[model samples]
Target: MSRERRLTAGAVAVLLVALLGVAVVPGVLADPSADGPVRPGRVSIAESPAIAPEEVDGATATLRLHTRIGHAGNPTDNVSVRFRAYDAESGLLTAERTVELEELTGDRSVPVNATIEVPREGGYVIETVVFRDGRVVDRDRTRVSGLAALGTEVHFTESEAVPPLSVSVASVDEEANRTTLTVAASLTNGGESASDRLRVEVVLRQAESNIVAARQSTTVSGIGPGRTADATVEVTVPSDYNYYVDAAVYRDGVLVDTARSVANLDPTETISANMTTREVEFEVSDFAGDDGSQEERATEAAARTETATATPGFGPAVAVAALAGAALLARRRTRQ
Candidate 1:
């Protein structure tokens, strides 16, 4: 063949290989096989897509959709999932998102998650499409109604340790030796729904040592959209010691957010939140003579002993048990 004809023929052969999905390696077609993330396979939808209301803002509703894409053959190229929301009445596209998919290895199925935000007034038709190498392989559609009735989740957060203690002061009494602090962590619910019974865990630590002075959990109620509430919990600790108040916000028993703030009561000492916290020390000297503190003091004197990181030489045990042991030892010595 002439040189010009040979060049044309070579170009045509390369085009044919690409069309057949064969990888040309080292100037040779290697066993008609594909390579890399761009290869296509039998991409199929294995189950019906699932849709649920995620959140609601002032005038819009957010919905989450989940799809499981399965492959029937060998490993394919990198895939993608496209979620589209269309107005049910006008058939106009409202929102769309494409998520890049991870390549399937030994796992035959990949779960894809997507969310769409639309006006909360009407119905919507959600469509899910799977694409491989820029080509649509599979598509599915589902319908959603009663957007107005979709309940939005109220997100609660604790931003600071004691942000302008909101409630009445009678719940906490400030004493000279030890004071009770009602940590009012500012929680904001930006979602469209109102929620109650949100839980917050507040821990008070001595600034000089990581020793946990008190830990308490309390519920914040009446949280509404764009409204701020307080996660208040009372923690009574030694008065002179500066304290770091740490708060953790949890939903359904799962930790969702955390925050810290300082309550520097001692002018001579400095304390900050977010530092590591440690266990308790048992001794009457630690909590002696404080009015109405006997119950909390006794709880600290429980059997479970912990090494006091801050208070060196503070023995681990109930203060009563320690005193009893000492008395027994003194009697034995006297008898001897």
Candidate 2:
């Protein structure tokens, strides 16, 4: 044979061997039966199961699994299902249970049920795991919320002597520029039952126009009977309006009590124009005495000199000096 023809034949033989290796070698190497019995077809979570709340301890979660087996595969027997409950906040396992299923065949849906106990009232999670033999085949998870029943009656009380639940605005302070109002309130629970969730809201509105100025809210948990809780909220309002501060209390999404107080703002202190920059400055101490209280005097002076001026011995120079001294003392007191 010629040298070129032999080389071409050898190249063709190498090309055929490469093609066969690509197609056949991987299948032979990947076949699990070459080592042992092949693993059965995969399983998956099929449907989202329903979760129902049980009265006191916890909730019940139902799960469904879909098993897909190949036509030539053996029946999957003695598969394990594990249900675990975890606290959503802390992610700690709170409850767990396991069940075993009978032999599963091609394209079948299996239903499993488990009850999870929640330690406290909050968010919780349920996880389902399907195991074939000792290996995990599929897993699924869902979340649930637990809430306690409102056992005790809740009401609003205006009188301090009355109990169960009461809310009152202790004070309303308005800044001199009428930009913000600070509301402070006290909440007392005199009822026999404690509230796990409590919400307090403070709203500011113009008394004359009934226009809402600002609203702020805060929350507290575990307010026991006969215990008192305090909340403060700062509300922004238009400058130069007589506003009313309303403090309200809520339990379990229901409004229980509300108290109202008035905030008298000076018309001159109202902000007339909108400020665009955040660095705008104002005198904080200017509103310190804006509570409308009369200025206190340091000392009291008698007008004995008025009557003494009628006496013949009283001299003009002495009277003038006494008047000037009194004026000086008054000026000094004003500064103090």
Give the top-scoring candidate (lDDT).
1
lDDT of 1 at 30: 46
> What lDDT is obtained when candidate 2 is compared to the true structure?
0.59
Can you tell me which runs of candidate 1 are displaced by over 4 Å? 1-176, 274-336
Task: Show pairs that collide, candidate 1.
Answer: none
Q: List the residue pairs that clash in candidate 2.
A: none
Q: lDDT per prediction?
A: 0.69, 0.59
Q: Which stretches of candidate 2 lie over 4 Å from their true place?
A: 1-42, 57-73, 146-336
Clashes of each: 0, 0
Q: How far does residue 132 in candidate 1 sit from its true spot (Å)?
A: 14
| lDDT by residue (tens digit), candidate 1, 231-267 | 6677776665566777776655545456667776565
The TM-score of candidate 2 is: 0.35
